[model samples]
Target: MSKTDFPRRENFCEFILIRSVGNDSYLGNIWSDEAKFTKNGLFKRHNSHYWSNTNPHVFRERNFQESWQFNVYCAIRTDRVVALEFYQENSNSKL
Candidate 1:
């Protein structure tokens, strides 16, 4: 590691320690690499007998395609919400 990198790393570790004080609430924060889910009216079983199953494999795949998914970023402090952000479908922010 270079000496120049020490300040940046030190700042990050300091930030984590400060944020973590008395609050495990940091664990609720969503990370970039984690998977996110959104609700979409696709694979859900709305009707019981509306569809017939022919090939189980194809049906299984169609179910997946019909489901909905999305990502959200939010932060909750001790007794108050510090941040709540809903990103666009194309937003790619990471931390």
Candidate 2:
């Protein structure tokens, strides 16, 4: 397969720290419109946040955008960004 085979699909992504229910964790909603995928997995136009493939053409990602941390990402692949996302910052380092 080639990179063109993977269709660009729009989607919304949000991460909630499950341990924050009552553990007093400050991690809150981490949302991003940059949840859209490509042959490169998830990506964001603002920063260099992207997925890393383990092998050639393998869809499984071994590394994530560690620099992304806790932020709402907006994707820009084609020409316009239509996805909407909302998120809050957390005092923790591991979002």
Candidate 3:
């Protein structure tokens, strides 16, 4: 946000954290707790099966693995959420 977007001279922007386990969900505060986070993976093209011209591969089960994505995005502010905890089984797909 720019300086002109500020509504007042002093403002407080609170951070929010949320988690979901399939149908169930949970919401909590991230500022008060000393939260630790794992670094996100690098951005690059990912291919499970390699392409080859000289070799012929046999077909097996097409479903190699189940892939799920997760991300944590904070607003543009000084007091922002720096870290987060993400459980594989129960993770929030969106903010």
- Candidate 3 on 1-95: residue-level lDDT in tens? 45765644233322222233342323333333222223333222233455665555733233335544443433232345555554333233452
The full ranking of all candidates by lDDT, starting with the best, is 1, 2, 3
As for candidate 2, its clashing pairs are none
Lowest lDDT 10-residue stretch of candidate 2: 8-17
Q: Which lDDT tens digits does candidate 2 get at residues 4-92? A: 54442211122223444575533433323433344454445456544765545545344555434433556443335545544545323
Task: Mark the 10 consecutive residues where model 1 has the least summed lDDT.
Answer: 41-50
What shift in Å separates residue 28 of candidate 2 from its native position after superposition?
A: 33
Over the stretch 1-95, how does candidate 1's per-residue lDDT look in tens digits?
46878999999779978988888878566433222444532223333343556756443323556565655556665466666655436345553
lDDT of 1: 0.56
Q: List the residue pairs that clash in candidate 3.
A: none
Candidate lDDT values, in order? 0.56, 0.43, 0.37
Q: What is the lDDT of residue 8 in candidate 3?
A: 42
Q: What lDDT does candidate 1 reach at residue 2?
A: 60
